[model samples]
Target: MSTSLLIMGIGGQELIVIVVILLLLFGGKKIPELMRGLGKGVKEFKDGQKEDSPTEKKTEVEDNK
Candidate 1:
């Protein structure tokens, strides 16, 4: 079996490909707007994830014990 990473971005090529795809899909004028929305969505999701994770509850219980 061979293992390959798909999103490593180790050589900046991953970013280049993503930029090309975004430009093709959204045009240069819209890419920044799309990225701004994407960034907000990611940030909101991360905040929600932190609020819902069981680890936080576990720590609360551990502290009580």
Candidate 2:
């Protein structure tokens, strides 16, 4: 509910302004590098989550035994 509210609060103009601010702060050359790093970080987090789930299930099974 709160997420929806937050999304709705940002109109097109607001998003454009935010994007313009980001471009000004980071410059064109740096943004791609920043985004690539961010993408890698998110991918690593997802891979960690995938690796974690099977271990958690295995531990649960051991506890039941």
What lDDT does the true structure give each of the candidates? 0.81, 0.89
Which regions of candidate 1 deviate over 4 angstroms? 1-18, 58-65
- For the record, the alpha-carbon RMSD of candidate 1 to the native fold, in angstroms, is 5.8
Write down the lDDT that model 2 would get.
0.89
Write model 1 residue lDDT over 1-65, tens digit each, in one string.
11344444244576678778888988988988978999999999999999889999899989999
Winner by lDDT: 2
lDDT value, candidate 1, whole model = 0.81
Q: List, residue by residue over 1-65, the lDDT tens digit for candidate 2.
A: 35774777976677789889999999999999999999999999998998789888899899999
Candidate 2 Cα RMSD after full superposition onto the native fold (Å):
4.4
Candidate 2: regions farther than 4 A off: 1-8, 54-56, 59-65
Give the per-residue Cα lDDT of candidate 1 at 16.
74
What TM-score does each of the candidates earn? 0.53, 0.71
Worst 10 residues of 1 by lDDT: 1-10
